[model samples]
Target: MPASSHRPSPASPLEDDNLLPQILLRLPPDPSSLPRASLACTRWRDHVANPGFRRRFRLHHRRNPPLLGFFDGCGSLDFHPTLEAPERFSLKRDEGDGVRRPLGCRHGLVLLLVPKPLQVIVWDPVTGDQHRLDVPQGLTMNECYESVINGAVLRAAAGDAEHFKVVMVAADGDGVENRRAVACVYSSETGAWGGFVTAPIPYDADAHASGLFWRFSTSIYIDHAMLAGDSLYWQLIGNFEGILQFDLERQSLSVMSVPVPIYSKGNCFKLMRAEGGGGIGFLLMSNSDYIAQLWRRKTDSDGVA
Candidate 1:
């Protein structure tokens, strides 16, 4: 203990450089894009790729928590790391009852659907960049059929941040609508919703009905480019039989089957975003309690599920 040195003046009581660690716990690592985020990369891969991030991202989204929008009705939007409780920033509705439709998360923007307007609204929630899109018009609505249909919006694939796709399934339409349930893919980059990819009916019934009661189940991000090898996966309600998968590379839809003994009856309980990134997951709803089941897209299933 030299008098001159004096142990660096007893560490100066507050000469703290360890503040970085404490701050880190409060500030999450930089998040990667939805697709490539799960895969390893040099872009803060270790931190942004945390499974915790994946889980939080999914839960917050699946359970957006209904918020009374600036309209007659209300629904909640995802809480982006940048904007927590985005429902607070939700823009007012112009005409619809604000039937909240959690389309999908793309480029930090939450895609929503106003059931009454039959329109799609792209919400920034953070910047509150609200854009409403009237569902094309002229093309007959799915309600024309007695079958059943669901509309979902999803961010395309990697490197296509500027684009988003809306997939609508009008299962078993009467007259010409049978098996004619076309998948309408809307590209924001293209600024239009075009093409009829034909959504194969996984269930003969309304798929969303649970025990005579109409239950609205959301499609959970099952797996990302990681599992699809290039496509994104989503788990829909109606007996967890299969997942509706969209191929970002080719822009197509196929079914991802469930493993044996799992028997996804089609009633997927809770939808969770995958921790591995890229996609989301599902929670099995049971009377006893909520149990979770997991799966990834198998390149071999080929829509059989």
Candidate 2:
């Protein structure tokens, strides 16, 4: 046999152009996975950096993206990384002189409410892209109570990652008996704010009948927009404690009272998606009993479990 016949082949499956990408696609969907792999050699770096490979990597792990980190959204916009050491991703930014409160985070976008000028800042931490949108006329600070301004940010379409939309909800009241919940949406693709959708806040029947004007100071809690089905939910605080529902498809706003009365002090509750992708629900923790209860919204009726 010739000497050349005894030599090993130049290409293996791992080194093959066609098979290399398929192997790389199976890498764990961590923020630092690709970057760490790229440090191996020049070829691996080029393979991971390719636009097509990047897109495929995202889609391949779309179902369960890594929990990169979370924003505190308390007094400032701070991102606390969950990944350890080398894999940690930092998103620290100068909030400037104006106070910025996080409204909600969804679909890889963060919604922030700037109180001074009354605008929402749509921020993408990964790409460092920001889109500042002025508050809609109906939900502006002048039009609605500034303290109750809350909103949500989500992608325009499920598969469309580049563009997003913002839904801002605020409580409009006359400080007497006339109180309404107003919402307006902003679309990135259209670059315009949609018309206002208003829903009257149900008055306290007992107070109204007693000849005393129902004046409950209501405000939407910040940084907790829970999306279920085609709608978003937020917890309402103040004299009226309930869950505010915003239907994305119908562009309507409604309120649902909680299963039990939520006391103003030491009330710990969070809205969440029910198990098996059922519907919106909430986990309530009793301060005194030190026990947790999971309540699922009944699909058949307006009751809570």
Candidate 3:
């Protein structure tokens, strides 16, 4: 048989440009996955480094991205790896003053709060990209209760890993009858902070009757924000003990009381997505009975839980 007539053995399936990406896309969505794959050869490196491939890789694993590690924001800002050796990644410890606190992490980004100058740092550990945004005038130290400020970071749009947005919320008051919740959002794409959204915190009659109103006035304890539907929820503790809601689509702020009353301190509660992904809710542990209760916001009703 002529040499030209005889067919050469089938080239490795991965040699095909189309097939190569499909195989790489199945790789675990680990911090070191792409980099390690790229070391294989120039061809593989080019495929892994392609912008299109990167986007697809993220989308393919969008539903369940691996928990690479967590930032230890207690006393110091450090990353503790959870993955095994060789695949594990490490981030440089925060060199600035220990005032930096990790407010929340979502969409592969970390939101940090720096209280001194009242700034928010949106960091992407994988990309080593950092964006420092000045706190909005209304949410700044001089304007609001600086110690109670918290925020969250998320992708600007679904399945979008490049652009992101930061939502910062704070409780502000004059120690009089003007207590309120204020929130402002910073968009990376726009490179600016949006106008402030304010919601009046209703007076707690019980707190006032117990003579605890004044002490808690102008002060609030806000937990990390949780995203659900088109809104972000934060568990509020203080005179106005409820969940503060920031509607991303409407750009409005509102508050909803918890199903059961909870005190300012000595209570354990968390804001989370309701079961079956219905809506936002909270899990509260009763101090007296030591029993946990799950409460879901009634999206069909008027914010009842």
Scored against the true structure, residue 79 in model 2 reaches a CA lDDT of: 76
Q: Rate the local accuracy (lDDT) of all candidates.
A: 0.46, 0.74, 0.77
Candidate 3: segments with Cα more than 4 A from true spot: 1-15, 86-98, 208-214, 218-220, 264-266, 299-305
Ranking by lDDT: 3, 2, 1
**RMSD of each candidate relative to the true structure:** 11.9, 4.4, 3.5
Predicted candidate 1 versus true structure: per-residue lDDT over 254-305, tens digit per residue: 6544443222344344434555643545545444445555643223356532
Q: What would you estimate as the lDDT of candidate 1?
A: 0.46
Range of the 10 consecutive residues with the lowest summed lDDT in candidate 3:
85-94
**Of candidates 2 and 1, the better by TM-score:** 2
Higher-lDDT candidate of 1 and 3: 3
Candidates' TM-scores?
A: 0.50, 0.80, 0.85
- Worst lDDT run of 10 residues, candidate 1, spans 217-226
| lDDT of candidate 3 over 144-193, digit per residue (tens) | 43577888899999888789999888877766456788888888898998
